[model samples]
Target: MLNDIVKNLLKEVSGIAEIPANAAFNIRNNSKSEGRHSTENIDIVPKEGGSGLDIYVKPFTKNENVHIPALITQDGVSEVVYNDFHIGEGAEIEIIAGCGIHNCGCDDSVHEGIHRFFLGKNSKVVYIEKHIGEGDGSGKRIINPQTHVEAEENAYIEMDTVQLKGVDSTKRVSSAKLGPGATIVIKEKIMTHGHQTAETSFDVSLDGAGSSAKLISRSVARDFSRQLFRSKIIGNTDCYGHSECDAIIMDNGVVAAEPEIIANHVDASLVHEAAIGKIAGDQLVKLMTLGLTEKEAEAQIINGFLK
Candidate 1:
């Protein structure tokens, strides 16, 4: 039986529809099999150690986006997943995957997922993933994720990762390598509160001539929470790379922004910008003047910034 929390989480991380017959869905370590679509274009295999699930997409597959969202609703439950995807030559597709934890137990629950993508020549892919946790229990919620990407010649990839709320701690590391004429854009968003901690690091390399990379990251922290944002972009040959980081902090929270740009060749173009500060008092006051309580006004401000 699905709890209200898990159901709402699925709706946010994935979509609020019936699980497609051809979709690969998993919870904890179990994969739904009944009426599930089993297409030759994609592969979902069990890890040898019964730890998680592995996903792969074959060449020339233009199928719809796959929803592979997992949930941890019980305390004392820990989950791990390692997903591998291969987008074949000239293929274009979208992938949506995420994890949500609703803990009501006395012990901490944790989720760690590692994902890798291999993009074939001239292919394009869009990927979106989000994480969230909710509950009033004494148990803690933690999420750690790592992502690696390799783009072939002329390939293009866009990735969006989000952490909405309720995660007590998290550390994310992401890196990508691009080939000639390839391009990649990454957008990451994070929010932390109530003594939580969140850290993210990104490393992107435009290794081939004419390759390009761009990274945009935004974060918010409040109520004594801590956050670390780091981005490193490397440009080789005649490639170009750019990175930007923006953050908002409140209530004695600690926020750190570190952006690095590396140019290995004289023709390489690399640049970066970073800004971290607390929420503007005027923004909060303006919202409160619209007949909202101070708390409600703050919430609206944060939501608008994240949106």
Candidate 2:
């Protein structure tokens, strides 16, 4: 059974309002395991070092979903967890993960999560993660996340990451190495406001022939907030890579985008795009002409852009 706070945090992060009785899941709260379940084709086992869990997906498994979410409810608590995923050959799965923090005391609450994925040949996986913070206290909410991926030949992986709201400070990093014929796609969205700061870094190495990678990020900064985005793609063989960053700034906010691409082979191809600006006047005017207020129009535009 989950308490009200844990339930709410679970819902906000992973959209799991009620725990599924027949699905694979591991819910961690304040560095402790709240609940766990394992399916026939998927297994979730705690690590021997007491750090995190090792999730295994059997070969040829399909249409399976796994949820691993963490929450921090008490103030002045800090923890680091390491979770690893072993994806078997020919398996296709979806993993849902996120973290939420609720602090009401005069001390900072922090959680750092490290995730690594090892993909077998011809496997495919989609991973989604979201972060949020909530409270009325004077303390800060801090979260740092790191992800590493190793994809074998013909494997494919897609990562979707979002920072929803109320995070005071965050630094996110992700890196990947791809084998022959492998591919990876990453999409990230973030919103920062009220003196908050957010930073994101991504590095991908196309180590084999026919490997490809694409990275796209969109962000909104408002009310004195600051954001920075850095992306690097290195092609060691004949491969393709692309990176893009688009941002909107408002009300004294600041945003920076740095992109780097390196082609070590003659057949390697790479491209990068970055754009940072405020909301367009014509967009606001069109929405206002349709019976919307200025604030409402701005909110709608931001929502659409992030989506």
Candidate 3:
């Protein structure tokens, strides 16, 4: 049975209103597995001698999704977990994973998660993750996530990561290496306010011929919050790579974006773009002419920007 708080947290982070009877899932609460289920094509096995899970997707499988969500409801608790995903050859699947924290005490709560993905030849994967925090206490809510991806020949992987709001601090790190004809795309969105801090870093290597990678990030920092975005792309063969970072800063907030690209072969191509600015006055004026207040217009703009 799912408690109300856990259900709400799961919905907030993973968009799962209730546990699905026909789907594969592993629900983790307060560093322990609360519920787990597996399907014929997908197996969720506990990692031996470890506090994590090993998820395997059978070869040639398609149209499946696995949910792995973590929730923290107690204060002064901290945990670090490792999860690995093995996508077999020619499989097409989606993975939804996230973390939510609700701490109502003076002590801080933290969750550090490290996830690795291994994509076999010709496999395709869509990965989505979201992070959120909620509470009325002085305790801080912190989450740190690290992702490592290895894509085999002709594999494809798309990742969408978001940090919605209320987190006091976070550091997100991701790295990927692509094989021949493989491709990887990553999209990230984040919002931080009220003295919060967030940092993101990405490193991608296109090491095989005809491989490509794209990384794009959008973020908003408000009310004295601080944000940092850093990305590096390396093209070691005949490949293409691009990285872009865009951010909005407001009300004494600070944002910094750093990007680097390297090309080791003559046919390698790489590019990067970064922009940091506040909301445009013209946009606010246009929205306000529709009878919306300044605050409403700002909120609308920020919502759209993060979307």
- Which sections of candidate 3 miss by over 4 Å? none
CA lDDT, every model vs. true structure? 0.81, 0.95, 0.94
TM-scores across all candidates?
Answer: 0.90, 0.98, 0.98
Instruction: Pick out the ten consecutive residues of candidate 3 with the lowest summed lDDT.
Output: 46-55
Candidate 1 residue lDDT tens string, 181-298: 9999999999888889999999898888999988998888888899998888888789988888888888888999888888889999988888898778898899888899989998
Count of backbone clashes for each model? 2, 0, 0
The true-versus-predicted C-alpha distance at residue 260 of model 2, in Å, is: 0.4
Q: Which candidate wins on lDDT?
A: 2
lDDT of 2 by residue, 154-271 (tens): 9999999999699999999999999999999999999999999999999999998999999999999999999999999999999999999999999999999989999999999999
Tell me the tens digit of each residue's lDDT in model 3 across 83-138.
99999999999999999999889999999999999999999999999999998879
Clash pairs, model 2 backbone: none
Sorted by TM-score (best first), the order is 2, 3, 1
